[model samples]
Target: MDINMNEMIKDCLFFGMVISIFAYGFGKKLKDKWKLPIFNPLLIAILTVIAVLLALGIEYESYYASAKYLSYFLTPATVCLAIPLYQKLSLLKKNIKAILLGIFSGAMTSMGSVFLLSYLFQLSHEQYVTLLPKSITTAIAMGVSEEMGGIVTITVAVILVTGILGNMTAEITCKVFKITDPVAKGVAIGCASHSIGTTKAMEMGEVEGAMGSLAIVVAGLCTVVFISIFAQFM
Candidate 1:
C-alpha cells in the first residue's frame, strides 16, 4: 500500500494544478490583506510554489512537465492586451509618433543598460545572453533567448524578476523623475516591465492602460528584431 501510494503521488496528474491554484489563492489573500505591491500575486505564487517544491524534495523537471500546460495561454494572453489598445485607438493614432518614439527609446535603454552592466560586471557570455531580453514578455523572450543561444530557464527567471521589480518601483520612479504624462508613464512601464508592469498601468487610468498595452506589443517586436540583428554578430 505504501509503494502504491508513493507511485500514485509521483505520477499525480493534479499535482501541478493543485500547486498553481493553491499558490495563487494564497498570494491573492496576502495581497488583499497587505495591499502591497511586493505582494503581487505572481511573485507570491512563484515563491510559494518554489518553497513547497523545495520542502517536498520535488525536482523541478517533474513539476514543469505537468505545469507546462499553463504556457498554452501565453500567446492569447498577449492578444488580450489589444483590448485596451483598441479602446484608445483614436488617441494612439493621434500621437503615433510620440508613442512609437517612447517605446523605441525605452526598449533600447532596457537592453542597453543590461548589456552595459553585464560588461561592467564581467558576466559570463551565457548570463549576458540570458538577460538581453529580460524586459520583453516571456513568450517572446524565450524565443529570442533560444535563438541567441541563451538558457531559457535563466531568461524566464530574469524576466520574472525584471517584471516584479518594474511593477513595484515604476510609480515611485516616475514621480521622482517628474514624468507627468500618462502616455510616457505607460510606455515606460510596458516597455521595461511587460505584463506585470501593465497591471500597475491599468490602475493608473484607462489612458495609461491603453498606452501600456500598445507598448508591450511594440517592445516585443523591437526586442525580437534587436536579438535577430545581434545574433548575426555573435
Candidate 2:
C-alpha cells in the first residue's frame, strides 16, 4: 500500500501542473475574446482550478505538491519587473519625490485602514496582523504575517483578494477619481494591489508599468517598517 501510494503521488505530480497551465491558457483565450476586466485570466484560472480539483476529488495538498513548482518563478518574475523601471529610469528620477510620497501614503493608508477596521470589529492581534499586510506581495506579506504571529494562510488569502480587487477595479477607480497621470495611476495600483495590479498597469502603458514596478518594491519596504511600528501599538 505504501509503494502504491507513493507511486500514485509521483504519477500525479504533473497533473497539477498541466491543469494549471491549461486553465490559465483557456482563461487567457476567454479574456482575449471578451476584453472584459471581469474575465481576468488569473481570477478565472483560480476559479477553474478550484472547480477542477473539487470535481476530480483531488486533495489540495496533492495538487499543490506539484503546482508549487510554478511559484519558483515568482522571485525571478518579480526581479524582472526592474527591467521596466530601468527603461523609465529618467522618468523615475524626474518624479522621485512624488513617487516616494505617493507610495508612502499608500502604504500608511493600507495599514491604518486595517487597524481601524480591526479595532472597530474587535479583531484579535493575530487577525489584525494577518490583514495588515494584505496590500503587499505574497512573499513579504507571508513573512510579516509569520513574524507577527498571524495566520500565514489567511494573509495569503487576503492578499489574493486584495490583488484581484485591485486588478479588476484599477481602471474604474482611476476614472472615478479623475486620475489621469500614468505615474500616479501606477503608484496607486502597485501600492494597493502589488504584482497582480502591476500586470494591469503594464497593459495600460510602459510608463505606468515602470512606475508600478518601482512602487511594488518601495511600498513593500514601507509596509514592513509601518507594520512593525503599528504592532507595538497593538
- With a 3 Å backbone cut-off (N, CA, C), the pairs that clash in candidate 2 are none
Residue runs of model 2 more than 4 Å from their true location after superposition? 1-11, 79-87
- Local lDDT at 42 for model 1: 74
The residue-by-residue lDDT of candidate 1 on 1-234, one tens digit each, is 234433444677778778898899999999999987788787799889989888777777677666777766777876675676576677778888988888888788877788788889888777788888999988789878888888998898888888878888989999999999998998889898898888899999987887777788789988787765543432
Instruction: Evaluate residue 173 in candidate 1 and report its C-alpha lDDT on the 0 to 100 scale.
Output: 91
Q: Pick the candidate with the highest lDDT.
A: 2
Residue 49 shift from truth in candidate 2, angstroms = 1.6
- Candidate 2, residues 51-158, lDDT tens digits: the string is 987775667788888888887786687667567557666767888899989999999999998899999999988888888999998877877888999998788878
Clashing pairs in 1: none
Model number with the top TM-score: 1
**Model 2 lDDT on a 0 to 1 scale:** 0.84
Error of 1 at 134 (Å): 1.1
